[model samples]
Target: MSDALNVEGIIEFFEKNARHPLTPEEIARHLGVGRRDKKRLLAHLDELVERGILVQLKGRRYALPRKVNLVTGTISMHRDGYGFVSTGEPEGKDIFIPARFAREAMHGDQVLVRAERGIRSDKPEGRIVRVVQRAHQTLVGRFEQTRKFAYLVPSDPRLGQDIVIPRNARGKARSGQIVVARIDSFPSKNRNPEGTIIEVLGDPGDPEVEVLTIIHQHGLPHRFPGEVLAAAEEIPGEVLPEEFSGREDLRDLLTVTIDGETAKDFDDAVAVRDEGQGRIRLWVSIADVGHYVTEGGIIDREAYVRGTSVYFPGRCIPMLPEHLSNGICSLNPDVERLVMTAEMLFDAEGVRLESRFYPAVIRSRARLTYTQVRAMIELGDTEEISRQGEVYPALQVMKTLAERLQERRRLRGSLDFDLPEAEIVLDLQGNIEDIVRGERYFAHRLVEEFMLAANEAVAGFLSAREIPLLYRVHEPPSAEKLQQFQEFLSHFNLKLSLRQGQVAPRDLQQLLDQVAGRPEERMINQVMLRGMKQACYSPENVGHFGLAAHDYCHFTSPIRRYPDLVVHRILRGALGKKGLSEHEKQRLAQTLPEIGEQTSARERRAMEAERDIVALKKCQFMVQHQGESFAGIISGVQAFGLFVELKEFFLEGLLRVSSLGDDFYHFEEERHRLVGEHGRRVFQIGDEIQVRVEHVDVERRQIDFVLEGAPPAAAQGDVADDGDS
Candidate 1:
């Protein structure tokens, strides 16, 4: 028998046969396994059973889980006590597990689910049959005490159960303090999980403690390991002369970096030149992080674990130690830094004529902030232009090329949501001073266009060489989501055209353009965004649906993103004009899939942590403004309430339906609105209304609002339009 007759072969045999459960002897006989391989075959069967891939039935028979109406996946618990199990298949729909059927599976736990009938055929329900792996060995929560014993209320509501902490296990933790607890016993159907306080963070309301809570709750790595730090310390702080031996010397290219004013780690620098006849040559140089952190080394291993840097309001948990992320690999101005450069030539219509990548050494001419670049380019400020000195001419060329590239993308049907992002301002003491819409000028878009061009160019380049690398893929929306979106647009007298049961990016872009300057513009944009699929890292290239590009990957910020660093390594191999060797390709092919999944999960964790901390800050800021009235727009409508976004502070709060004291109301699911039965009042998304800040719950990160005036009466079952008021 061949060595291939292992786990994979066993699964293949089961899949192909699709017969009744078979015993180990029967299965081995079917595969023609020899006597020497019998022990290995038995071990493989046991491993599959443990992984929930194969279920060992009664009488020592084995069958695929699906054959027994069982699905294996990670369970994601909702705050309302129910959970959903994701099968991790591209076309698989989540199986809903009701609160009663959830059993003991908590959020993120991999479990075996027994399929059950549900009301909707499209949505299947299931019950947890077994927990294959526990997601949380420890949890962060608020400490609480009673007369006899203490317990922890998990900061993450999805946990669904409080962990009981025995008196002896409480340690120095006091009531109302944030603490980390290690689970001593997992939750069961009849009892909650038991844990001991491992570390007490601090009082909940403290700014530092609030941030720390989110960090621990999400399991983010905040500090570098000593070995990783020592490895980083071993690297030189400056680029040596011999380091540029085999690299192109672009030190005199008048290159400049454009970033936020507060940015310390500059990863990308750009230089542009007009080559006459509406032709432009652009160079995008990114920090050569892979050159320093070799693969599978101490630093590389830690960076792989971190996946990506996590940024909060005033702090960041960097992927690499500061010595590398902020020093030699940073590409700081006036210092010679090693970089992987993407050089391309583009014509007037923003069509890429030619592109190439190479290792290079560059001395940055200047570091420019987005605000300054905007002033110089958009406002044509003389002082700002003069202040840039030697790089002024290059900035002008950069602006022209960026505009052409942006227009090309717009013409090609790229979706630009342009949604407002909250920029949290902090005082000297780290307390939130204000929350406002972040400024996004054309200058920001200018850099974005360049980065997109380089990313696509590099992806296309490496893909042509047949190298395996991670691609930033954004698949199209599903047909069901498109139908729901079309229904929503119909309520606003709008329509989304679908081609062959699929809506194209251009169709959505057209709809966006039609709704510009209208009252429902923001609401429609948000809904359309929700309908689209999330972009993730994958070894297989599905193309980026939102960008409307055939090839796309993240290649600009290798310092912060692991996927970018991976791409850089592949690009470097191809730079020698000889792509990766057979051994290297085989290794990557075997590992890239798992790497993609791990990095994507870590990315989501970082995003969730960032969102939680920002919401906490917003709630804290709103505490002082309780009971004050503000103009707002109904951003979301659900059965229980309407979520209103305040105009002044950009904070969102719920206006519960029960608070509509004038009349009884019912939710119109299709219309996405709440309608009063007797008064004929309406509360729908995009409707401008006045709301008073009734309450703010910092612990739960919630804000509650009440109507400022009596509910406005409208025609029966009619949506309030912009002209209605």
Candidate 2:
């Protein structure tokens, strides 16, 4: 039996019944302690209070700290030394903690905090009482040596404090070099942490070294282990004859892949056929990654850890090694590859009549680029169509079906927010060449419509039978966010109908349509998009709001996404003649929630890493173009600065209010603009103006700009306003 005086057990009891505070006598009775042991239990409770595990009320009642208005959450620190704790509650309210109350808690650290509601302002406040876990044991930063002392300044701005490096802990790191340091001691409230330099990266000015620093800072695995490489090498290059048994033979189907010019892994392919009487049969073939990488295998575990493939400026960190991702699993032309097929029959009005899912072995008829497909279907280029004999006819029919599906989605109020995405250009040595906005054509939309149809069909099939699986769910926006968005739009004379504390997707669709082609179109669309919740994976079906679909799952691109691979496996088990066993079904039900959370985190991490690299490269490109003037649109306006996006280049920079030639500017938050008191000039969102690149700070990944035609302070007395900034 456990000890009767166990302090941990006493704390656990309070934690388990945290909602109900218990007096000393009640706690003693609940612990089954007699009068003789009551004194010992009280002593233990006092000790727990001392350790911040429990709190004693004014009436001498005991309770868990969380029960007494204290909460637990992860802290996100800022460069200015303050932090915000995210409690992950449905209300989405973050608790602001002052720099003094942080108690040395680092960024990403989990901590217990005492919340003070509606005290200082409308926003809630919190104080860190105890740190539950540390997020970092090693740090990446630049090393500096003084006359008699040394220190490391962290590369991540959120680290909040520098680490002191003792004389002996300097290792071989030289001054002004980037190095990885292992923390020898965590920080106290009044003292900075100490660390030892372990690995010395090269100088900070080198491009290659900066990229490596980013990878190391984010804890990304850049190289495969020896065992994993060995395992990848063991896989054969060709599909075995025995592997095709019991699989549908789709070699005769006119299937083709449409991807970018540089894409090596073609995981999805499309085919179409006219069924006569205004009907069509569409096939979406996705590479069967589950067939090659079994569950709990080395490669599978690695893929799970990586989550998704991360694409940088000129390189890719694939989830799987090249042997699998680009070779066997890729649906290369003329190669027999295993795939899972979703065959759906649709009427002329783009309503699904029937759908079927099955395992299949197929040889891709041709590898087509988005440009080539657009040339045939939209541009009607005879040369492009003649290049592919039988596949050309199938492509034409696919276009017609895609158009119908798009029209159907339009009627259903599926939102299509066309935000411009930037694509960075690089030279052979990985240096910045240029930045260009991503283009959209009919070919891109056609492929997207077909994929969406296949995903919806597969998801609907499994959902109808109540199977446990990870679904890509996009929930509706929270009421608080919607109300804020409505207030923001009210300034522009637009009204959103909020009914019964909820708004429909069509309401947003109508608003977007009303503002189309206006100067405020981009601003309104961006704010509305921000008000919506991000799409994430969940075992519980919440439906997809953005897609306007009752059921949706990602079934294509299994080679790049772990959830897609898991979906393929589940479908394979369920499609068999015998179906799944009771044990298998129960196991899936028990494990899918955790997998949903894990894959969601991994996807976010990959996206963040990709975004960081792009920003880094963009900053590098701007260094060469400093002082060059370009036409730009005001993307954002704040109390301090205006954010401008260049027209000819996919780049954005900030123009500080201080650079406006001695005018005192005041930010008007309600109208989303800034006004100068002396000159009476105004700058607002969506106003086109000319700006010159003033400065670029590569270390901070920031670009600064100045207004191109602003007069000097001596000559500003008689200038006309022109109603423009």
Highest lDDT among the candidates is held by which one? 1
Report the lDDT tens digits of candidate 1 across residue range 1-725. Answer: 86557888888889998499999889878988888998999999989988888988899999988888988999989777889999987668899999987759889999999988787765789899899889899999999998988999999888979999998999999898999999999988888999999999999788898888899889998988888899899999999888999999999898999999878899999998899999999999999999899988989999999999999998989998999999999989999999999999999999999998899999998999999999898899999888888777888888899999999998999999958899999888998888999999998998999999999999998888788889999999988889888888998899888777688788889899999988778889998999888899999999999999988999999999999999998888877666678998998898999999999999999998998888899999999998789999998888777889888997788877767777888999777899999989998878999988887888778887888864432112333221100
lDDT, candidate 2, 1-725, per-residue tens: 22545886787776675568788888877777888887788888887776556777778987886677887788998777879999878786899998888857988887888889746588888888777778889889999999989999998878978999999999989999999999998888998999999999899868788788888777777788888878988989999999999899999998899998879899999888999988999999999999888899998888888878888877888888899899999999999999999999999999999999998999998999999998999898998778877877888899899999999998998998868789987788878778999888999999999999999998998888877878999999999999999899999999998987778887788888899888778788889998888899998999999889999999998988999998998888889888878888899999899899999988887887787888788888888898789999998877667889999898788887767776777899988899989888899988999988887877677887888876432222332221112
How high is the lDDT of residue 502 in model 2? 79
TM-score of each: 0.95, 0.91
Poorest lDDT segment (10 consecutive residues) of candidate 1: 716-725
Position 657, candidate 2: lDDT: 74
Model 1: per-residue Cα lDDT at residue 278: 99
Candidate 1 ranges with C-alpha deviation above 4 Å: 119-123, 709-725
Residue 51 alpha-carbon offset, candidate 1, angstroms: 2.6
Query: Top TM-score: which candidate number?
Result: 1
Task: Report the lDDT of model 2 for residue 702.
Answer: 84
Clashes of 2: 0
